[model samples]
Target: MRHHSTQIPESSKLSWMLLPTKKNTDTVQSTTDVLIKAGYIHQSQSGIYTLMPLAQRVVTKITQIITEEMERVGGQRMSMPSLLGPEAWKKTGRLESTGSELFTLTDRKGAQHILAPTHEEEVTSIVKSMVRSYRQYPLRLFQVTRKFRDETRPRAGLLRAREFIMKDMYSFDIDQQSAISTFHAVEQAYRACFDRLGVPYVVAEADSGNIGGELSKEFHFVSAAGEDTVLTCKCGYAANEERARGRGASGADMYEVEGSEQRVVVPAMRRPNLLKIKQAWPDCGELTLEHRKSGEEVASLGQMIALDEVCADGDYLVDAAVDGLAVEGIDNFSNVEVGDWHTAQSGDACCKCSTGTLESQTAIEVGHIFYLGDKYSKALDLLVQHDGKRQPVQMGCYGIGVSRVLQAAAECSSSSRGLRWPVSIAPYLATLVPLENNMEHATSVFATLSNICVNGARVFANNVIVDDRSYLSPGFKLHDAQLLGIPITVVLGQKFKQSGHVEVQLRVPRLEIATCVAGVDVTGDGYEYKAFVHVDQLAEFLVCALEGQF
Candidate 1:
């Protein structure tokens, strides 16, 4: 037998009242079911999802934007196979270097195959065989296709996925100067793309990593869900996590090591704390510790620690070549951290801001462009004859993570209640509904709104759905309307019948709502009164509102 009690503490009673109870559980469940039925989208794996109709429509529009931008940049588009041959990757050494990261298999005839993580080797191979001459000094080519990475740990919805879409591009130039220009050109094109999408981003120094390049830059869109960390400064200095260099003052040389200076040998005490040694021997002044591991012929002071400190078990001996008495230790060459004297300050000069100091911020990279130079062309024998001299074609690569943008947008703008999409990416601009079961009033209002939609007004972009289904309760319809987050909603029912006008509700204001009552006058031919502010006016308002926001 079980007994239950409804007991509440005096102090907790008020807070409990504010808590959401189980009474709304059924409503939430019903909403989820409706969303699934409407085919918004469904996650099959941790980060992989199947886009339903509603989601598909949004993504299709985004893809169209990307296509337009790529074309505008003079990028010649093409499609490559999702599956690729292993021979090209093997020749580049990535087949084994990338190891299990490369998804590989054997065909029926036992021919090696690999799902490409990137297309550099393949594109270079094709160019090697097709191009011949310096005349084709510069070339820009691209493709929007599906790529597989088999990420070790995929999470964060579409922000990190095993299979995703990417716009990978390759550029070729005759020389280093031309390659640098091509890189800048691609960077500009990427900026235009994100601008059109209405997402804020920053370009920062980045490491090419295993991608194999001398220089690289990443475009990071500010969002919490972003996986990469960015170090930013008021001086307009931004850099990727791997390439982040904390601003610091190069400290003065603590100790000078003259070739002939002699210090007593201490074999049992092989490691001496440079800082402590200098502190104990104040007359010796600052300490200059050598980092033997740096492999440089000249020994430079890498770091300094407290003097008189005994060596730990982990510490190792680096016999100071100067006198052999001042032994160095493993702990001397550690990385610098924040609060160091060398860190960048607010007043530092910004390359972008000119005289303005740099400011630091966090952001996620959504796109990147790399100029490959002739790394691939040289490997694959890709060459062109120009003036009777065969030369390798310069190449560059560009990438945009399509799925990541959606998650980034969601991360950047959303509240506990629901998501507030940007105007350019909102699922729909308006939802039309009648407040109560007044069929005549509701029907008449529908006709009026339909005309506004047909006129290509800004209130709706062909995605409006009128809930004329009479069986549904007004409460349920209202709940759906809110969940959809439509910018505007119109209610025509019993309330309007007495008032003799339709009610227009604008959901544009943040956490607040406003309504305007517009008179409804039906004519003899069944024509309703035209709105004082026509659909064109509504369109203009929407455009202006969105323009100011993004």
Candidate 2:
């Protein structure tokens, strides 16, 4: 078995590519190109990746965001073993419930063990043994490490896979209110982490798969291709399939077709067909309906539009002039589509800005945070002594899709040429390519670029590749740079050799590039070549440019 080195060089490049003596050299090179060019994931074996320097750096950066937010939101870090004793899982009935998802094995002692798909049982058992009082009422613990799941289909790159990194955090509270508070804190942290990652996301209601819980939510970056479908309401409510609500029951009262108003129905419609209903009653005042079965009533009218005037009053319902008026109840809340009016529209509550409409886009769900009531604690009998009585502790769990994030980055940032990475997630900040075989000039240019990169690195944000092969051509190098998606590339060629400056290209464009060199140079080449910038400055420039686009 061949094991690749896990040591990340300070220079952040692979010292050597590992290959079995039997594998063809050309095949290995091809594989390397496919992995590096597509993004910064290099396979060390058939199923494992080496996480080339650039990819590794992005992973680390993402992890830092997770850590910072977790800490800020009251999650204490704890390192749980990748290999957990099967007995602990069996204690919670998970060994029987999650059979195949668990990676089971036997040690030399013939004792059974299972890789932890999650740490709920382990964390609960530990807390049960250590805590026996109310003082430790709201305890939160977490771990950032690799997790294993025997996935059935590992496709769409790392979006779904067998083994990957994860940050799982567990919280314990004596009361439901405290546990809910802790849960909201972690949820806020998750939002912050995604924000830092430069990805747009929403806290959608999600099913607690395997991890049985009452009130659970998934933080989804909505995408058409995303695995989980999130349904959001124009009223600012959003949830995954597990927690999404359908159209509820509206009152039996009919409305005038010619009037205008928006009404809130109790037991909201699951599959609201506004168009179908609108066609039925085109002039009805904004109406509210309720499901007869649910028996839930509206507490207060949220927002109502009476014709052209926007009013916040609830008692004003004009008499309907149409005899065919009827209230409908829908039962399917599957997913939100591009044109779904059931979803939040413009002028709705914004997650960040107050002015913009509540827009929805696609994003892969790489992580989730949930507040698990005593569902597991009561099931597993992991109770603690508090206030002279033993009671089940409220729990919460937070997870980060260590591997899915990598794939999401690729999916969002790739272009026709190849996978261009955001500098924040790029394996290398920049790739130094010398266009021709002018060894002397290439070496000199490499040194100059290396010096600038080192300066950036000192500030905790810089990377570069010094081209030493001296074999590839300018066009080839340019193609490879675009393919790799590095934010910046420095070209050293016959032209650069003739002048003191290098032709720096920014892989990711920004307004600053256009502004910095605005009116500086222009030629009617039929293509809008905006500006010139140094490779070292590209990362910072792009960072500033893309601050809010996500």
Candidate 3:
């Protein structure tokens, strides 16, 4: 793990990845682009990518954390097939239901096979054959493997790729109560895993989405570049837009009644909630609602009005003709049209706690947990004998999109300088930079770093990198250091040569994260914004910082 500048790839020198978007920049580049230009990944196909060595190192650390957390929660590691037969999927109706996302292929013998996007069918098949006695009622089996899906459009780097790494765990239990208990246990493990990653995240209610389940939640990293829209309340109620529900506006919002000179105002169900409207009018299956902007498809975001810009009172009072009547969308308002209208807005009262208003933001989904009753077990015939009667085993499935979490960490953390990472998953813990053409000085500091240890292990050698490219300028090295995301940087320069001190810089530090201190020989140049340490007390300083004591 000891790396020198020569050992690293040149693609990593693309500092252009961190370029900030200027005013009126029409296109916004996301973390995916940043990762590509920075040489962490390479696109092999339209929706497939190859992780570079540095990216692989970071991915390995993330996998290790997930594996440790999985083991902590009583999960036994095991591998399942990436290619699955269609029988079980057919039985579960997922063969047809899974639809386009499924990757299907035919062998030379003309037998069809599927590249699994998930393993519920395969895992259930395993349990059906192996576990039957109620004594073995509770079981948790997991695996870290590559998964495939035929994405219509894959963007956002590793966040939504056709092929990616995933950690999937399946839980089996004898009864509903036991299954729910197992679900909570796995939930805790997910929380612990994310907590260790050091990025802020949210646990929001979620829809099962192609993967069938009864109870579900999503673990999200809030980011402007995220594709999923999430609605949250200060009261702790959060859900993805697909599953989020807001109470109907008390009164029909003011609008111009189409085909008439009358402006109307009344309480009405928005076209945005067309499905809910259909629930009230079961027979009106053909009903359709449109946005007031020329009545285009209302199902999209063009219909959502910002609550903040609207009336502060939540009562959108308008001086209409006063002849407007209150009626739901079902009472023959299908052809009714108007100008721009309103739907769920940020300031709308939260459905969970009325005191809090619903606010919305986009977020990346890195993990998902589902309480998947007996659907899979029943379809796959995973029955266990209990009290002399066989019953379908209760089950649940949990998944962490391993690669998605990696890129999401970058998206959540990167400043204009470049990508950032949590200490636990950074490619390396520290970097050694020789501020002059002093390879000898760098070698000396590297030896000290290499000698540093904790619990009798050579942790530093395994987590430290020396910038040995003597041809590169000190400023260039420092600039690259910011983009590399190695937390502790030691600089050997004129000051170090004069006083046996090497300046240290801690990138993007927060005082509250950890509690440990080490002395610096002296402060850095006055022109600099901050000086982390002078690489003084080197062993104690780096050991603590790399161990998340920064």
Candidate number achieving the greatest TM-score relative to the actual structure = 3
Cα lDDT tens digits, model 1, 135-213, are 6557777887878877788766666677777788888887778888888877887887877666678888886756767
Per-residue lDDT of model 3, residues 204-305, tens digit only: 888786787889999999998788878889988888776665654543443333332223233354433333232333343332222242212221223322
lDDT of 2 by residue, 1-550 (tens): 2223233222533223221212123432332344544446755544456675556767887787788888886777878787888776776678897988778899999988888778888888788788766787678788888888887665555666677888899998888888898888777778878876765567776667677676677766555557665656555667554334342122222222224323322212233334334433455444433223221121122223112111111322122111223312221111211122232232334433343334344557888777889877887787877668787888888888866786676665554456656555566656666665554554444444445422334322345654443344556556666666666666666655564445565555221333433222422222112233343444444344334333
- TM-score to true structure, per model: 0.67, 0.68, 0.79
Top-down lDDT ranking: 3, 2, 1
Output the worst ten-in-a-row residue range by lDDT, candidate 2: 304-313
TM-score of 2: 0.68
TM-score for candidate 1, please give it.
0.67
State each model's CA lDDT, in order.
0.55, 0.56, 0.70
Quantify how close model 1 is to the true structure by its C-alpha RMSD in Å: 13.8
lDDT at 60, model 2:
84
